[model samples]
Each structure stands twice: as structure tokens, then as C-alpha cells.
Target: MLLTLAKEIGFSHAAAVDPSSLKAQQEVRELCAADRCGHYGRNWSCPPYAGELTAAQKQLARCTEGVLVQTTGNLADEFDIEGIGRLMQLHSRRFATLARQARLLYPKVLPLSAGPCTVCRHCTCPTRPCRFPQKRLSSMEAFGLMVGDVCRAAGLPYSDGSKTMTFTSCILIMQ
Candidate 1:
């Protein structure tokens, strides 16, 4: 049911995933700490502010399963930064909508997106409280879960071997 809804909502791919298989590795968190994306400590949903990876992992482990979703798009070559950004924005929007709908079925549904929460242009972190706590999104990396690993555990292809870009996310339903 969730998978169908995901497809209807415009996700390129959706698959059932076992929460236990989604391990939060220290290496992944370290990458976030590196701050190459310039998102670390800048928001309530990024690293440091997103909380410990162990807590995220434990919470996800308690869930029975989840729906792994992805948005894949052709980027006129790997350097198509504009195309990539557009696809990512599309993915973020779809993810937010999906999460809201998922909450109707499971009030405690946890949404882990492919990147930092962008609901607001500027997040007031390390100072003021999140303006939209209910709408905040925590990235998969912030949770320390490697995207490729999650896709493999979910029996989904992380890459189709094509020159395309794919952003992945998941909504763990703790029912």
C-alpha cells in the first residue's frame, strides 16, 4: 500500500526494507562531521543537532520495517548541477508530502531524507528552536545510514549502471 502511494506520489523507486538491516555506521556520521555539504551544525536536522547516530539507529531498529524510496533522474551528464538540484528539490517535496501522509497511518512514522531539511531557507539552530518541529527532516547520513547499504539491504538497486543520478530516502513505520 505504501509502495503504491509512493509511486503515485512520483518516486522513481520504492521497496520494503527491514529496519534491522539499516545499520548506522560511524564512518557515515564522520562524513557529515567533515561538513563537505556545509550543512553540519547549521540546522536542527543536520549532524550534531540531529542527535547521536546510535539513538537514530536504535529508534529505527525498533521499527518493524520501512519503505525505501528514491528519485532517479537523467542528468545531461554528471556535471548537470542544475538538473541535479531540480531533481533533489523534487525529491524533497515528494518526501515531505509522503511523510505527512505516512503519519496518518503511523503517527510515529520517522522520515529520513537524502539530504538536510530544506523546509526553511535558513534554519535557526544552536539558538532558537525549530520553527517547524513537526515538519523537520533528518537526513539518512545524519542518522549514519549509508544510502547504498540501505538499498542493498532492501533488495533494491542503488544504481542501474546508467549515467543517472538517484537520491534515496525512507520512512520507517513503527507499527
Candidate 2:
């Protein structure tokens, strides 16, 4: 029922992952510390501002179940930056829509996306309050989650193969 609802809401793939199955790694936190994704300190949904790793872990602990969602798009090439950005944007929109729908069905949910919140071209983080706190989605990485490991634990593929870009997001549902 969850997977079907997810797909109907536009997720290409969805699976239930037990929250207890998630294992947070300091190594993943290190990647954020490195600013490899480049949005580290620039966005409200990313690192430093997203809160401590322990806090993220605690948030996840409150949820008993989650749905891993993926939207995979075929890239023209590895250097298709434009294609990649477009795909990510598309995936984010779909994820946000699904999240809102899920929120209606579920009493409480925490939606984590593949990247920082793009609800606005310029985020008003640190300087001002989030304009859409209710809609703002946090990044999975910022939540101290290793997307690949989480996918594996959920019996899902992190990658559909090379030349294909996959954006992953998860909705932690409290029941």
C-alpha cells in the first residue's frame, strides 16, 4: 500500500525501510564536513545549519518506518551538468509533492531530499527564518545518512547503473 501510494504520487521507486535498519556513519558526516557537495554552509537544509549529526540520528530514532524513494534519469553523459541539475530539480518537485500527500495520510513525517531546499533561488537561512518551514525538506546527507547504505538496507539499488543519475529521498513516517 505504501509503495503503491508513493508511485501514484510520482516516485519512480519506493520501499519501506525499517528506521532501526539505518546505521549512521561518521564517515558520511565527514563528507559534509569536507563540503564535497558544495552546499555545505550555503543552505539552511545543508550541514552546519541542519543541526548536529546526533540530532539527526535522534530524529530518525523517533520514526519507526520510512519509505525510500528514487527518481532515476538517464544522463547524456557523465559531464552532463545541465541534465543533472534539471533531473535533480524534477526529482525534488516530485518528492515535495509526494511528501505533502504523505503528510495528509500520515500524522507525522520527516522528508529528506537528495540536496538542499530549492524552494527559493536564494535561501534565507541564518540571516532570516525559513519562509516555508512546513515545506522545507532536509538533505539526506545533512541528516547524516549514507543514501547508498540506506538503499541497500532497504533492498533497493543505490545506482541503476552508470550513465544514469538517480536522486534519492526518504520520508520517515511516525505511526
Candidate that would win on TM-score? 1
lDDT of 2 by residue, 36-86 (tens): 777877888887888877878888888878889998889999999999998
Model 1 scores worst on lDDT over the 10 consecutive residues at 156-165
What tens digits encode model 1's per-residue C-alpha lDDT throughout 12-99?
Answer: 8999988878788889989999999988888899988888777987888778868999998897887889998999999999998999
Global fold similarity of model 1 (TM-score): 0.94
- lDDT of residue 126 for candidate 2: 71
**Where is model 2 more than 4 Å wrong at Cα?**
none
Backbone clash total for model 1 is 0
lDDT of 1 at 97: 90
TM-score of each model, paired residue for residue: 0.94, 0.92
Candidate 1 whole-model C-alpha lDDT, 0 to 1:
0.87
Best by lDDT: 1
